[model samples]
Target: MINGAHVIIYSQDAEADRAFLRDVLGYPHVDAGHGWLIFKLPPAEVAVHPAEGSGSHELFLMCDDLAETIADLESRGVEFPDPPEEARWGILTTIRLPGGGDLGLYQPHHEPAYDL
Candidate 1:
């Protein structure tokens, strides 16, 4: 039976990234001891899109309000390298993470599947 999913982000500066996730993003977490932190994410979902050629997987954090969410994160010292772009799917932009990484965050235009 399929259970929940666990996503891992490999970071060059793991401590800093953990700090960013804990302090800045404010995702409640527990230490696995020795400073290893496991964060609890908000509700999540997965969708598959067909591609022509082989492609890698990607992760995106979905939100309800794009502007408001961006404002809140920005206030927490998060950086957005590009402005949000509107598409049929949603409004999206990349949020800069520690160690020169980025995470995809978007406000979805489609109906959420949380009820299912």
Candidate 2:
């Protein structure tokens, strides 16, 4: 039986990213070994989308309210490179990670599977 999912974010500055996850986002994590921290994500869901190619994936953090979540994150010193845009599925924005990468954040317009 399937139990859980483990997501990995490859970063140029792994330590800095780890600190951001720990101090900024406040995700509880356990150090695997020598400071390799694995974060405990909130309830998660997976979906399949059609594509021309394979071997690619994405990660997006869901929120109940985009504006409120943005405000809360901003107070904690997080940055969003762009404003949120409306989509058929949701309103979405990208969080500028300390590792020089972006993580998707969105408020879903459709029912989310994580609740089920």
Candidate 3:
């Protein structure tokens, strides 16, 4: 069985991205050798939505309180996709990552990928 998968993001400002993931998102992570940082992310839900020529990875994270999460992030100077909308299968919102890639925040309507 597949245990888990780690999505690695390449950023020009890797340190800043690491801090954002750990500080802003409040996810526990570690800095590996050779200037690589690994984030211990929650179980994956959404699949990778690759952008043409961009190579950006899109992930959907399950949240307990979408409203509260959004509020807290916004207060911390994070710019979320204006007017979050409910997609067919989930709530979709976009966040700007440090390296100009868009991060998707989603609360799926179907069963969550992991237990809350």
**In candidate 3, residue 77 scores what lDDT?**
81
lDDT of 3 by residue, 17-79 (tens): 787888888897676887566888877654556477968444666676677788888899888
Which ranges of candidate 1 are over 4 A from the true structure?
A: none
Which scores higher on TM-score, 1 or 3? 1
lDDT of 2 by residue, 1-116 (tens): 97898899989999999999999999999999999999999898887878886757899999999999999999999999989999999999999999999999999998999877
Q: Tell me which residue pairs clash in candidate 2.
A: none
lDDT of 1 by residue, 44-111 (tens): 88889988789678888889999999999999999999999998999999988886788899999998
| RMSD of candidate 2 to true structure, Å | 0.9
Better of 1 and 2 by TM-score: 2
lDDT of 1: 0.89
Order of candidate numbers by lDDT, starting with the best = 2, 1, 3
* Regions of candidate 3 where Cα sits further than 4 Å from its true position: 46-57
**What pairs collide in candidate 3?**
none
Better of 1 and 2 by lDDT: 2
